[model samples]
Target: MGYFLLSRLLSAAVVVLGVACLVFLLIHFIPGDPVEVILGEGARPADREALRQALGLDRPLLVQLSQFLQGLAQLDLGTSLYSQRPVMELLAERLPATVELALAALLVAILIAFPLGVLAAVRRGTIWDRAASAFALLGVSVPNFWLGPMLILIFSIGLGWFPVSGRAGLSSLVLPALTLGSALAAILSRMVRAALLEVLGEDYIRTAKAKGLSARRVIWWHGLRNALLPLITVLGLQLGALLGGAVITEVVFSWPGIGQLTIESIQRRDYPVVQGCVLLISLTYVAVNTLTDLIYGWADPRVRLGIGE
Candidate 1:
């Protein structure tokens, strides 16, 4: 267990470091200068030069990279080029909305996916299974860009059941959450159905039936638990996908989250904020994968034991 944990931690650290450096370098290399964006084209050359010097854009790329990494070591994310606010502070302000949306979406996925998946797996070729399969296909087929606006048009504009945009309250969150979660739910439902179906055919399932455990108990307790490994794996990986989708979903709904912030930063050529957002997203992805590995060890003892041995 110790070894497994240590290895995962080390790998996570390496990944985070690589992502931070890569994002910084890539942002710097991108066309259009932050200084140019901050200072208008009509600005005097002397003024632009002074502003560039003040922002440290005049410094060598290696020096800037060094400073950025050093600041990261102390959890400082630097100041936003456009806002002149601490990157960390800006992220702190917006993080909650993104987290709320992501969690809500995850909940929506799990709630909708699990039961439907189990039912589909159990019923196999029945109409219930077909219906679930059809829903999954539809969910996967729809992209967030289209789904988000269509949802807003129908539910918010047409029916007036929900707010059109912004993070006002629960009602406001519903549309974006559904838009972000639908694809995940679709993918997960299929995964769950397949995993459970495979587990159901195992020898132990037949033994559990022979032992006269109630059908629900045998399926939910034994079959589902065994099926969870793959399901959890998908959930962890899909979390990153959720974050990526949040970018589009938040934009469509005008949600005040880091996803929107990232887009805005990019358009404004705010390198610090953009770098911070990407780094934050990358760190989150690594952390979730690590947590998933830990869950794997807990859910299946063989995982940890095998690593330890």
Candidate 2:
């Protein structure tokens, strides 16, 4: 286990380094001058030159890249060009909201998907299975950008059950969470149904039923436990995706999370903040995938042996 963990951590570090270099180059190469954006077009050339020099934008690209990489080595994300605030501090402030939204969304997805999936698998070709399949189809078909507004219209404007936007309290979290979770639930439900159906056909499941165990025990204990291996994988991957996908939902709802911050920084050409946000998101993706690999070892001992290799 220790060896597996070390290997995963080392791989995660490499992925993060690659993401950092890629994001830095991409942001720099994009056709926009942060200095000019900060100082209006009508500003004097002297003012622009001074501002550019102050921000070190006047330096050669290689020099700037070297400095940025050095700052990263020292755990310094640098200051934002527009706000003059430390990029790390800004990210620290915004990260919790994004996390909260993602976790809440995950919880919603599991609650809706799990039972529906199990029931569909148990019922097989019944009406319940068909209905669950249809629901999954609808959930996947509706994109978050459109679903977010529709949710706001129905729940916030029409029903007034929740706030239209902003993260004030639990009530305010509902619509955004729903919008994000709906698609995840759809995907997970299908995975769960497939996994459970396969597990139910195994010899152990039949043995449990023949042993005169109650139907619930045979299904839940013998069936769902084995079926969870694939479900766990899906959950880990989906959680990582939720963080990335939150950007669109956050924008539609004005949620003040890292996703929203990324958009704002891009508009201002705040290179430090944009890089910081992308870097943080990339690290999160790598971290989650590493954790998922660890969970694989826990779920199946055979997987642990594979990891050691």
Candidate 3:
């Protein structure tokens, strides 16, 4: 396990370096003048030159990259051109909101999707199963923008149950969390159902039934336990996607999360902020993926012995 973990860590470092290079090259290739964006109009040539020099834009690309890497070593990303605040500080401020929202959505998805899927699989060919299927279809079909507004209308405007937008307390979190979780739940339900169906047909399940174990215990423990391997994998991938996808829900709800900050910075072509945000999101995605790989071992003991490999 130690060797395995060390290999994973080393590989992750290589991937992070590749990601940094890709983002750096892509951003520089984008057509724009950071100095002009920062200095504003009617500035004299000398002033523009000074600003460019101050921001390190006047340096050669290699020199700039070296300096950036050096700063990265010291955990410095420079201050934002617009906000004049450290990139790390801004990220630290906004990280909690995004973490809270993403975690809420994931919890809701698991709480709802797993049981629905299990029920559908256990009660196959019945109305309950059909209902779960239909729910999945509807979830995959609806656009988040439309769903968000409908939620705002019914829950916030019509029923007076929740706020229309903005994150404040528990009441404010519901609509956005549901808005994000609903679609995820739908997808998860389908995945879970399929996983359960496959696991149910295995020889061990038949033996358990033949052994006269209670149906509930057989399905919930024997069946669900084995079925969870695939669900765990998908959960990691989907959670990563959800982190990026929340940009829309965050914007609509006026939630002060990293996604909103990314959009605003992109519009103004704020390079440092954009880079920091993208890097953070990438780090989150890869970290989740690493966790997923680790989960396979816990979910199934044979995973370490090349059984799942």
Candidate 4:
């Protein structure tokens, strides 16, 4: 366990470093001088030179890249060109909102997917199974951008049940969470149903059923736990992806989360904020992937022994 954990953490560190460097270069190499973007056409030549010198834009590209990397070692993402505030500070303020929305979406996915998956597996060819598949298709086929507004219209405007936008409270979070979770739930249900169907065909399931155990008991107690291995991996990885996906939903609804801030900063070409936000997101994805791999190894003994043993 110790060795595995160490290896995973090391991999995560390398991935984070590579992603940060890539993002830095992407923003750095963008066309049009950043100084021109910062200062309009009316600015004097002397002022432009002074601004370039002050921002260290006068330095060679390699030197600027080196300084940026060194600053990153200490968690300093530099200051935004537009806001003149530390990028890390802005990220700290915005991150919690994204985390909250992602959590809510995960909860929604679990609640909707698990039962439907189970029923589809148990019922097999019945109408209930068909219905589950249909719902899953809708979840996968429809894009969130389109679904988000429709949810708002149906729940907020049509039924007058929830708020259309804003992050004022729980009511406002409902539509956005539902919108984000539905797509995820659809994909997850298909996986769960497939996993469960396979597990049910195994010898242990037949033995349990032959012993006169109730169908629900056999499925929940025996089949479910064994089948959960693949589903667990999907849950771990998809939950991380959902964090990234929430940015769009958050923006559509005017939620003040990291995604919204990241978009706003990008539009203004605020280097510090853009770099900081992208770094945070990339680090999160790598860390979560590493964690999921480690968890899978721990949960399945076959994976821990390196296969040959």
Which scores better on lDDT, 1 or 2? 2
Cα lDDT, model 3, residue 232: 86
Which of the numbered candidates is closest to the native, going by highest TM-score? 2
TM-score (C-alpha, index-matched) for candidate 1: 0.95
The Cα RMSD in angstroms, rounded to one decimal, for candidate 3 relative to the true structure is 2.2
Candidate-wise lDDT, in order: 0.92, 0.93, 0.86, 0.87
Q: How well is each residue in 139-169 modelled by candidate 2, as lDDT tens digits?
A: 9999999999999999999999999999999
Location of the lowest summed lDDT over 10 successive residues in candidate 3: 300-309
Residue pairs with clashing backbones, model 2: none
- Cα deviation at 230, candidate 4, in Å, is 0.9
TM-score of every model versus the real structure: 0.95, 0.96, 0.91, 0.94
**Model 1: per-residue Cα lDDT over 221-287, one tens digit each:** 9999999988888999889768767988999999999899999999999999999999988888889
Ranking by TM-score: 2, 1, 4, 3
Model 2 weakest 10-residue run by lDDT: 300-309
lDDT of 4 by residue, 1-309 (tens): 777778788888888889888988887776656566689778889988998898888989788788899999988899888778888888889988899899999999999998999999989999999999999999999988899999888888899999888889899888888989999899888888999999999999999999999988999899988999998889988888987888899888888898899888777777778888888887887878888889898997677666865
| Per-residue lDDT value at 23 in model 1 | 98
Q: What is the lDDT of residue 123 in candidate 3?
A: 88
Pitting candidate 3 against candidate 4, the one with the higher TM-score is 4
